[model samples]
Target: MCQTRTVGEFAVSAGDYSAVVVSQGAGLREVRHAGRLLTESPPVRPDEKPPLSAGLVLAPWPNRTADGRFVFDGVEHHLDITEKDRNNANHGFVRTVEWSLYDATERSVTLGVPIGRHPGWPFDLTLVVDYTVDAATGLTVTSTVTNSGDVRAPFALGFHTFVRAGDAPVDDCTLTLSAAKTLPLDPERQLPQGDPVPVDDTDGDFRSGRALAGVWLDTPFTDFADTDGRHVTTLTDPDGRATELWTDTGFRWAQVFTADPDHDQGFPGRGRAVAVEPMTAPPNALASGDDLIVLEPGQTWSGEWGLRHRDSAA
Candidate 1:
């Protein structure tokens, strides 16, 4: 049986939101919107858990590399092969670890986890994740990592959120991303090879709002517009309800995935969900040295991302 714990609650003029942090692997239990469910949590089917939400932090790395080995500081390091497809470790350490609750209040909750040196990653680090919700903004999550070891630590961070636009089928939804470049990948291993290509004249473009129905994407994109120091992306449904995602400067890349596990629904698509991921680095950062983030000893790094809903017709 799954266990659940209430962490915090925020009341807004639009509606009320609540946070539930679970003890089972310290996963986010729930993130409700206006008393309505905005995120799926506990009792979630196995397949529904991959796109974590209500703000969870992915550390050490974000996406996959061809192999589990990389060279750092003249040393070749091998990471545990977590993703069998490319024989690489995807994401970071905290996904499977249990976090300790550091603080909790009516509107926010803070949790912490320590990443210790191991065979895959030999760095001692401390990570903290804080989640909040506002009436104006649906949910905001912030994360900070501190290098507690003597040596400098190399890593990256990101969040994976699967958005469901009310009763709208994904095929009818429109995606708007202000990204200029899309990373080209090796067909066989799905690893980054050539330089990033412009979204124009390619199936990767979403700048002009594309319908999600016929779109298939599993690509990494960067060169996003720095909207006066803010980075934002939006997904709108036919009903005029929109889900907006905003992140900080450190998040330079975004990955959009559309999968349809239910084909019998006559949707003509795979899974009817849109995952808007925010990452500090691109895929295979450890090997490409493109998404690498260095943390000096005793130094801490922190950033925030959030989701807000708007009813244009209202």
Candidate 2:
């Protein structure tokens, strides 16, 4: 009689870590460490949409496609514009759609969906988002995309999650990112406007870690100095407790945004909150063909990004 829950919540736990992966968009809903919140999640009614894309999967292409138009493989296509104010196609088709439950285990849950929602995106691809969390290691999310179509398909992947360090005010938290440069964005459309800039004196220069009090950004940082296989970023509260987010080589870019409470659009928090997003490519990858992953028929692209909660707050 009643419609299905907007996003079915699948709960998984192991040791001191627990996570809830929703069926909608195969997105993450909640993640906790030792009963303390590790990621920021807004309260939602069963019929409500997930706010601010807090834990949605960004795929096919991340960010926006200007004018919802692009030419690829000598073919011209126009996507259905989702961001009318900017006249662009924002994110992709996966966020608000329902995903099939692929598998579930004590510590992990996998959800999947086939992409090709619009006539503009005519290639068929399957996506599997696997989420795993444990007390010893926190949470690890692996997104595997397979091309199941006759022709090659362009693709990229990203995950949006807001993190906090033990209930600390976001303004007092310090961020350290393992990035060497920042891509400038157009104020009007939030699209790439110029070449990447060095992080030296810019707000992007959080290499040594800096207070986020005065910085307001929705910028992409690239040129990761990943000495090891993993690129890392850290958000530390004033008292020294921190959360570490890391991405594997498949993910070469990260976007950091400062969400304001004065605006209080969707996110449910008192003060400023930081969204550290793991992205395979920067914005407008679909249009620029920059760092886009091309998956031939039967080919797949696998990438991982995760968070580790340090319990020093105890």
Candidate 3:
């Protein structure tokens, strides 16, 4: 029997926008604009994992930690190395876990999950994610995290969602990012190397918007433009139809991934999508203490991110 039948599913609709939120990890299952799919998340099956962490929330920590080990305060803590080949702890372990639907309505839903003290991560936390759709603003996600443990906790966040403009393949689309720098990764571990490098005049540059045709990208970008205190990225079709993702002051990084079919790593729907992830910190943050967020007991941290769409005609 398919276990998906037992999982909770919630939907919100307003105007031309509709979204499906799943119970597992409070991940988003799908989003559509005027009956057209806007994201890459397909309906999840009972025994299957989401394709490319689609519509999933990466929390507690984002990206990977080398060797799954980090020295916090004065103690050495070890996390499970989920990426065996790279010997690193990949995205946080909540995607497969279930979250409780605390509230739901026709245009919004709120899901909550509790994190207990575990061997790898010893901090206790209670996270609530609220997904809402607007008639004019499209979809907005607000996440709140409260430290429930007696001691302080280290935390970071990332959101995984791929956007598409119409049915065209990603190679025909243009990507415009409001970032000035790119984090270079080590060839072997694929982890961030030194400080970020300027993207201006380089292949990494996409300031004025660039066609993704032959560009291979799997990079973390920062130095985001603070226009009106918001950072934005857009993916557009040749005809001008577009989808825009915006992050608030809390997000300091954005990782862009092009799902190439030729890559050795298997990716569902490869060569068809591009993921523009809003992240609070970059890879190996847990070990570097760079841009990491630390919360004391009873403290709460919150942030927001969202997406909007525009038609070719207007």
lDDT of 3 by residue, 1-41 (tens): 11132558777889999888888878887788898777876
Worst 10 residues of 1 by lDDT: 1-10
Residues forming the 10-long window of minimal summed lDDT in candidate 2:
1-10
Sliding window of 10 residues with minimal summed lDDT for model 3:
1-10
Give one digit per residue, the lDDT tens place, for model 1 in 1-314: 11223222222222465545543234554566655445434354322333434234567777775578888777888888877866877777777666776766666667788888767688899988877766666778888889999888887887766655655677888888989899987766768888888888777878877788777776888988899787888788887677778888889998776655542222122245667889999888888789588888999998888777767663
Cα RMSDs, all models: 4.2, 3.1, 2.8
| Best model number under TM-score | 3
Backbone collisions counted per model: 5, 0, 0
Q: Which stretches of candidate 1 lie above 4 Å from their native place?
A: 1-15, 23-26, 40-42, 45-56, 262-270
**Cα lDDT for residue 71, model 2?**
79
Instruction: State the lDDT of candidate 2 residue by residue for 44-96, as single tens digits.
Output: 75235567788888878878889888778988888889999999998898988
Candidate 2 — number of clashing residue pairs? 0
Better of 1 and 2 by lDDT: 2
Question: Judged by lDDT, which candidate is best?
Answer: 3
Candidate 3 global TM-score: 0.95
